[model samples]
Target: MEIDYSTIKVIGFDADDTLWVNETYFREAELEFAKLLSGFETPNKIDQELFKKEIGNLPLYGYGIKAFTLSMVECALELSNYTLPNATIEKILNIGKNMLNKPVELLDGVEEVLEQLSKKYRLILATKGDLLDQERKLEKSGLTTYFHHIEVLSDKQNANYSKLLNHLDINPSEFLMVGNSLKSDVLPLVNIKAKAIHVPFHNTWAHEMVTQKETSGKKYETINTLRDLLKMV
Candidate 1:
């Protein structure tokens, strides 16, 4: 699976861990409740319970911070069963605010790689999560000029990928999906008969960590840093 970088038109990037730090904020939120909530529930349990409750409500509110924060707040209230005070809700809100305030700390060499890549390929940003949060980070990072299109989807499934390809009017064989999540980025691209480069992140959110066979990993190329992508792309 050799590629001529010159022929690659659109390079789609995953936002969270691939470009900047994300999971740290989520961890920080859980840690904020460790002292008070740990007596009643483990940190992992708290996150899982919140996530489970959120999943059930996703159909109603959809995705983004409005929904995510609401889910977190709702979960906290549910587990505490009105026993939690106003201060607890305030604490969760503060944590959510902090998560929203995360700076766009791009990974090492991300800017340089994107700058160079922009000269050759039509870069596109394809991310899922809060649209406003994503936009704010992108603006602060000043990476918007490099991208021709910015796509913030509610979720990245096979249908999302297929629809994107159709909208772009590009064949799957001509596209390359680059991101940190193997489940969301690499395998999904491979499933669509497209190529993907997995750039592993040091910190993977519990929900995003992926496990696949060595054979499955073969279709995907791995790189330690975004700069390493130059070798293939």
Candidate 2:
């Protein structure tokens, strides 16, 4: 089935892996964290346990480096049966701090795409993460000026998107979301009657992965890179 972008009045971009490097940092941090706990478990087992802790803690802390850091601490304590050394814990803390302080690296053509699209459509930053961290990255990204509205969501479900579009007075048909996660960015919008374009990141958190059955019949476009938007919209 053919879809139309002519009616799209607003284009939403996912922040983390969409406009800049984010998940990659988390992956690197996880590796460092696993190594830190190697005394208690092998790197592979440590990684598995940390992921379980993260998933278990998602409801309590939501998503972001802070939550992830906390999960790491918890996982370390649990894996070591609470005998983990103070130095190891400190290293974990430093790992999270380093991730937070790392410089923002924008993906190729992110600026050009935003610059071009902002001229014709209202662009919004519709991403879910720690509010302070997201704001910090936005400031560092130097792309904040392109967004007409910025939203830091707790989660990117259908209701969340619906509320954002409703507040902006944009009908679902007139909103298009571009992002890296099919679960968070594509499926939710498509379910809400909005158009979506998937620009996949090289790495994604396992929690965000959806089965083929979930996306098999979805109507949306998938582009290889952000620059590809120039040709589409």
For each candidate, C-alpha RMSD in Å?
2.3, 0.7
Candidate models: Cα lDDT each: 0.80, 0.94
- Highest TM-score among the candidates is held by which one? 2
Q: How accurate locally is residue 62 in candidate 2, as Cα lDDT from 0 to 100?
A: 98
Candidate 2: residue 231 Cα off by (Å)? 1.1
Could you give candidate 1's per-residue lDDT for residues 1-233 as a string of tens digits?
65444556778998888998876666666667555566567887987887787778877876656676787778877777768889878877777787787777888998999999899888889998878888998898888999998999878888899999899887888888899988788887888878788898877765566655623535878899999987777
Error of 2 at 202 (Å): 0.6
How many residue pairs in model 1 have overlapping backbones?
0
